[model samples]
Target: MVLLIGSSMFAQSVSAADPSLAELKKVLQSQIELMKPELKGKVKDLSMDTKMSLMAILAMHSRYSERATLRQVMTEVLSDYQSVLAGIMTDNPEHTADSARRLANHRIPVGGLLPYLGMENISDERLAVLDSFNSSVEGNALKLADAAEAGDMVKAASLIGDISSGCVGCHGVFRSQPGVSDLLSLK
Candidate 1:
């Protein structure tokens, strides 16, 4: 597959350098940018695990800053979400549907999202809540795609709000840490 080959080539090219975290992040970002067009073209066909596996390869070979890698993945997801919103605003059903599919299939973080949010202790009850949050977002994203494909713009628009709520609820639960508020306020 192209993804594997790209990662392999990238690994070979960088292996001798012993790149710093910043350099590694930079290379990964560039690689991601290079792949974006190809990704957009085949988002619907891409399995949910594709991006994750690619990132895993990079992480495995590099210093592997989990937060930075997770942030990069989230950045890609944000772009897809923006495209979906733009499509809705412009009444472009095809774009909306495609972007929604991308959103639904965005990669899981290296060890999953909860640990990144500092929810490392993940009891069964916590996991159930996490699963609920994930289902809400993924399910709504799929429904959004269906609505857009069916030309039901109104329903698609409503699903966007539901998806946002799901994301916000999950963040509120996991990311509302003590330093987060201070960090957000910029001291």
Candidate 2:
């Protein structure tokens, strides 16, 4: 009887400690969702140049060689991106501002594409476009972030719409890449 009781207790503890895959996915999805309002607004109003720059950054970050699988690349990218965003949201104003500026520059390297695609090069045209987009949108995104941080959800919502429009404009101009499409597809 004691053995059975101990086994049951062990099973309960294990179950509590190990979240199900669905639960894990939901947590991740929620985190992504939390940033959506800001992202959508900024994307909508982003200049073509800024959009192109962001696309290039994402492309560069998503690149992978034979060593890493697509899933691995995506996981790492998302994790890193989330960390960056969290830092922006929680850090001191000066640090957040500096980090925001750095991201705005789009100079940070995020390694290669997904492993399945092997080694691939980023196109000059794409990079140029992204540079333009980043320059145009970064300021607005920062502004929205500031408002959101201040608890002004109304301003944040308006800005989020603007961002979404910028994104739509870019998608209209350029063929939507699979990754871009998937990112935007989130409700």
Candidate 3:
């Protein structure tokens, strides 16, 4: 795969160039910018070496910024979300309510989500965006719990869809990792 080859090349370059983490990150950002047009379906004759270098840089950069605790919390939330879905499908109100409540009240990591997300300079606008996403998710989650408690599976199903949308929308905005569609030819 191109990504694998790119990462291998990047690892080699990191050792060869001996650049600081900051320098590598700078290169990675620029490379991603360069690839944007190509990624968006424009035919750019960017060199394979340059493309591979970008991949390698991204691979190396991600190693330095891995968020273990945040990942763990997200894993827990995902599990709870699945449990809620399971409960709803099986018509178990207690199970659905409990999982929905846990999802709504999932613990925020120390220093909060934004810091863990590596937003160095927090602006009110960014904070507002995050708040908007969080509010939608939490509000819908609570409504899900209420609906489950009241044995209204129809309402609970709709709330779950809303919660899924909120999570995906927030991740699209804040997550640094490139998705499959972002990296590979999609035709």
CA displacement after TM-score superposition, residue 89 of candidate 1 (Å): 0.2
* lDDT tens digits, residue span 84-155, model 2: 455545644444334433333332211212111111212334334434444334445566557656755456
Scored against the true structure, residue 35 in model 2 reaches a CA lDDT of 32
Candidate 3: C-alpha lDDT: 0.55
Q: Which RMSD values do the candidates have, in order?
A: 12.6, 19.1, 14.3
| CA displacement after TM-score superposition, residue 27 of candidate 1 (Å) | 23
The reply for model 2, stretches above 4 Å from the true place, is: 1-126, 135-138, 176-187
The lDDT for every candidate, in the order shown, is: 0.56, 0.36, 0.55
Best by lDDT: 1
Ranking by TM-score: 3, 1, 2
Ranking of predictions according to lDDT: 1, 3, 2
TM-score of each: 0.55, 0.31, 0.56
Residue 160 of candidate 2: its Cα lDDT? 41
Better of 1 and 3 by TM-score: 3
